[model samples]
Target: MDGQLLTYLFVGISFALYIGIAIWSRAGSTKEFYVAGGGVGPIANGMATAADWMSAASFISMAGIISFMGYDGSVFLMGWTGGYVLLALLLAPYLRKFGKFTVPDFIGDRYYSNTARSVAVFCALIISFTYVAGQMRGVGVVFSRFLEVEIDTGVYIGMIIVLFYAVLGGMKGITYTQVAQYCVLIFAFMVPAIFISIQMTGNPIPMFGMGDTMASNPEVNLLDRLDGLNAELGFDKYTEGSKSMIDVIAITLALMVGTAGLPHVIVRFFTVKRVKDARKSAGYALLFIAILYVTAPAVAVFSRVNLIETVSETDYKEMPAWFTNWEDLGLIGWTDKNADGKIQYLGDGPAMEGDGNKPAFDGVSKGVNGERVIVNPSNSVNELYVDQDIMVMANPEIADLPNWVIALVAAGCLAAALSTAAGLLLVISSSVSHDLIKKMIKPDISEKGELIAARLAAVGAVVIAGYFGINPPGFVAAVVALAFGLAAASFFPAIVLGIFHKRMNKEGAIAGMVVGMGLMLFYMLKFKFHLFGGGTSEDWWFGVSPEGFGAVAMFFNFLVSLVISRFTPAPPLEVQEIVENIRIPSGAGEATH
Candidate 1:
């Protein structure tokens, strides 16, 4: 079959499978909708968690970031995976033992304050909605590129599919569907990576292939060749660090804590039955996630080498078909500056001579017919950096792979985006319905009414998220960074203090969250939005970029909470005993309230 046909076939089959699962596992009660009735097996929960965690950013954009950023990109790999360690060891088991339906439930009951819980719900909604918008945007990009449909049409189709299953089956349906998505996305990502690895380094395992000797010349190590290429192109080395030590450390810490604090990932643990299952599931989740994390750097190396080799030595007119196809997509373009019909990819700016050589078009202003054939136009400058998100999607075509593989990749990208979108939407809906409406404002509301409210809230969130996707304020990486910062500053400290420290009063917890979130937002907007009339990073406070500002905010939260708790009464004795009960697994089967 042709590639496009195969793409449609693969995507169609996958969607059918998801819809089937939704029908098979539709929620029957509030318990089923919220926690899948707490009947999930650890292995299945692990798979679903992996899918939920690896969003469009991971599938479509991470490798591309690594490809261009070189060693600096290791921050993402380490930050995201290391977060699971924190979640498994410090957060997951205790949260599961608390046996709550949603994250805000734990905050409300543990702190003994509706006010604290309401504040948490507000922060959760903001973080999840911001994060989901990016995922929906990714879905639109994939559909438009592969299905040959308009971006808006693709988004609408995706929205309907997600709304159908997510509303029908709730968390239970989403969990089963996510497991299948995990399989599809992982296979799609690794197959091309393995093929490219073998072609470049003769190593089947991409992780090992990244550091192995090159097939073209075994004498030179893979890292060494990459360093040489980067130096030739006025870029940093692949193995050496470029960013300041402090920035790297701060950003990595922020991402790790933020990942642990994300409500959607935390809530997944509530679906499993036992505290032990939650711990075991975290280990499994990390293992499943590591497959792609390890393979990503290898893809980066292979694709970067291939791109340079294809473009560096060839004349612009002789560039490969993949180049032209991407150019048609507005991803790649070229100009014949000097009318010499030769495209130059060099270190110095365009129109500069090669060492003392004159411009490539200095003497060839007009063509042989004497018509005006200006070789170097006024704005014909070659930029070395291409958008990072394009690297993974464009990799298959760059390697001359079959069309079906390209289409399958497109489907995989959508799967990644949709799975995460569904999870984030659930978080938004649950915070509004379960936390705000049921617990705070309408304590006497019926279960059926809450469910209806939840569905309506989900629809509203989808509309807002769709708008952000269409007009994304920044690139994928930048948006994710902001999300991480917000989550870290607001949620991580609150949850950790609520769980591990019984003395943390509602007053302290609420105050800490408000202060943390406020400070982080201020710093982010100050650097990112030029709010308060502050200059860029060059004039930032202590040179902290918006990306690394979360660490500072989190620390301030901790310090204020500790100081405030000392001066305030601890949570009520009943709440203190409840915390004690949550610390053990024996009473987890019993309801605390």
Candidate 2:
């Protein structure tokens, strides 16, 4: 079959499978909807958590970011994976022991104040919605490019598929579906990577291929050759850091903490049956996630090398089929400079152009006329601006893989995006129905009424999230970073203090969330919106970019909560005993009072 036909077959079959699972495992009560009835095994919960954590950003965007940023992108890998270590060691087990339906419930009851719970609800909604917007946009982008549909039409297709499973089956349905998604996405990601690795280094394993000798010329290491190509093209070495040390450290730390704080991820721990399961699930989740995480850097390296080698010697007019193919889809583009039919791949490097022969743009080229245009006046090196997200999707094509493989990858991308969208929407829905409405607004509401409210809330969130996807606020990776920052600044501190420190009163939790979330929002808007004028790295307060500003805000939250908690009265004696009970794994057997 042709690639397009195969793509439809794969995607169609996957959708059918998901819908079937939803019907088979549909939730029967609010308990199942909220916590999957707290019977999930460690392995199952681990897979679900991996699917929940690896959103559109991780699946589609992380490799692309690493491809371009090179060594600087290691921060994302380290921060994200390292955060799981924190979650496993410090937060997941305790939260599971708390035996709450939602994160806000834990905060509200532990702190003994509805105000703290409300603040947490606000934080969860803001973070979940912002993150969901990116997932929806990714679904649209993948659909548009691979399925040949308009972006809005693609989004609607995604929304329908997600709504079918997420609304009908709730957490139980979403969990099992996510486990399947993790398999599809991981296979799709690794197949192309393995092919490229074998082609370039005669090694089947991409991770090892990254450091292996080149197949074409065994005298040089693959990485060394890549470094030479990059230097020749006026780029930095592949494994060396170009960003400042402090920025790198701060960004890495912020991302790590942010991952721990993400409410969608944290709540997954509650689905497992026991506190021990939560801990074991974290380890399992990391293991499943690491399959892709470790391979991603290898993919980045191999893809970058493949891209440069393919385009380095070719004239612009004779660019490969993959280049034109992606360009047609708006994922890649080029323009002829000086009316020459041939593409000038050389930049302002000494090897490509004569010394001091910088290339000049005429200010009218599609991909070549930006203030930071990749091309230089020297015309010595190729100045290309390929979108990072295209790297993984285009990897199979670049390595001359079979058509079926390409089509399968297209389906995998959709699976990854939709699986994550379902998880985030679940958080958004449960927070509103379980935390805000049932717990706070109408404590006497019946279970049936809460279920109805939850479904309605899910539908409402889908509509709003779909709108944001149609009109994306920012790039996929950047928008996800903003979500992480918000979660880190607002929720992580409150949860940590609430569980670990007996003296952390409701006042402290509320004040911390309000201040932390408020400050992070202000910083994000200031830089993202240019509220104070054109934003620049030089203009950052205390050398913190908006991406890393979450750490600073989180620190502020921790400090403020500590100071306030010391002066404020401690929790009531009953609450103190409640904390003690939460610390024990056996205590989780009882339902919440």
Candidate 3:
């Protein structure tokens, strides 16, 4: 069968499976909708959590970024994976022991104040919405490339599919559905890695192959060969750092704390049957996540090598079919300069070019025929542009893998995107329906009525998310980075203080959240959105990127909360008891339905 037909078949089959799971696991009560009735096994919950954590960004863009950044990219691998350790050890079990449906549920009751809950809900919405938009866009990118549809149409279709399952099954359906998604995405990611590893290093194991000698040139190790290519191309060394050590430390810390703080991730633990199960599930989740994380660097190296060998200095007119197809979709572009009819694959990446505001354009001069010269005697060839998000999805095509493998990749991309989007939609809906409406606005709402409200809220959330996907505010990386920062500043300090510090009061927690979140937002807007004339790195308080700004803001939150709580009245006696109870390992009980 043709590639398009194969893609349709694969995607169609995956959709059918998701819909079937939804039908079978339709939530019957508030408990089921909110936390799958708190009966999930550790292995199953872990797989679901992995699917929830590994969005389109992890599956699609991470390897691509790693391929380009080389050694500097290890920050993502360390930061994202390391954060789970924090989540498992510092947060997950304690929160699960608290036995609440939402993060705000714990905060509200722990502080004995609805005000604290409201602040938690606000933070949750910001973080969840920011993250969900990227997942929806991921779905669109895959569909647009594979199915030949417009991006807007792809998002609309994704929104419909999410609506079908997420609205009907809630957390119950999503959890089971994610189990299947994890299998599909992991398989899709590994197939190409195994193929490329064997092809390049003559070793089938990607992790081992990464350290093995190269098949093409046995004189040097694979990484050394990569370093040579990068140096020759004016790029950073493959195994050498590009960022300042301070910046790397800050970004990694932010990602770590932010992962622990993210409400969507924290809420996953509430679905488990016991406190021990929650901790066990975190270990399982890490194992599943690590499978992808460990293999990604190998994929990155292989793709980078393949791209250089296949395209560099080669005639553009004789380029492969995948190259033309991607170019037609505007993901990749090229204009030969110097009249050489060849592509220039060697150069510093986007961060090194231009005036830090515009794309780099090397040749704008006109030729004898009045045509723009794409290349000149200066060896300027700025005609090629490749979207980093396309790197992983396009890897199979780049390596000349089987068309059926390409189809499987398309299906896997959809699974990753849709699974994360569903999880976030659930978070948004619960914040609105459970925390905002039922808890505050209508305390006496019937269980059935509240269920209806939750489903309706989900529809609204998905609709808004779909619009963002159709018209993303910025690139995937920027928006996702913002999500982590918001979570880190707003949720992490508040929850940690509430659990560990008995003196923490509602006033201090609320004040700290507002200030920390507000500060991070102001900085991001000022620097990233040019809200204040595009503040340069020199103007940064500590040379922090907006993404890394969260860690700094989080520290301020901790300071403000700890210091201010000393001056305020201690939390109520009952609230102190609740905190003490959550910390204890014994007397673990089931969450009341």
What TM-score fits each model?
Answer: 0.92, 0.93, 0.95
Expressed as tens digits, the lDDT of each residue in 188-257 for candidate 2 is 8888888888889999999999999999999999989988988887777878997888778778888888
List the candidate 1 regions with Cα displacement exceeding 4 Å.
333-381, 585-587, 590-593
Residues 143-199 of candidate 1 have per-residue lDDT tens digits of 777777877778888888888888888889999999999998999999898888888
- For model 1, what is the error of residue 167's alpha carbon versus the real structure, in angstroms, after optimal superposition? 1.5
Clashing pairs in 3: 337-374, 337-375, 338-375
Q: Taking the candidates one at a time, how many backbone clashes does each contain?
A: 6, 17, 3
Residue 310 CA displacement from its true place in model 1, Å: 2.1
Candidate with the larger TM-score of 1 and 2: 2
Stretches of candidate 3 off by over 4 Å are: 348-381
The lDDT for every candidate, in the order shown, is 0.79, 0.82, 0.84
- Please give the TM-score that candidate 1 achieves against the real structure: 0.92
Q: How accurate is candidate 3 locally (lDDT)?
A: 0.84
Superposed Cα RMSD, model 2: 4.4
Model number with the top lDDT: 3
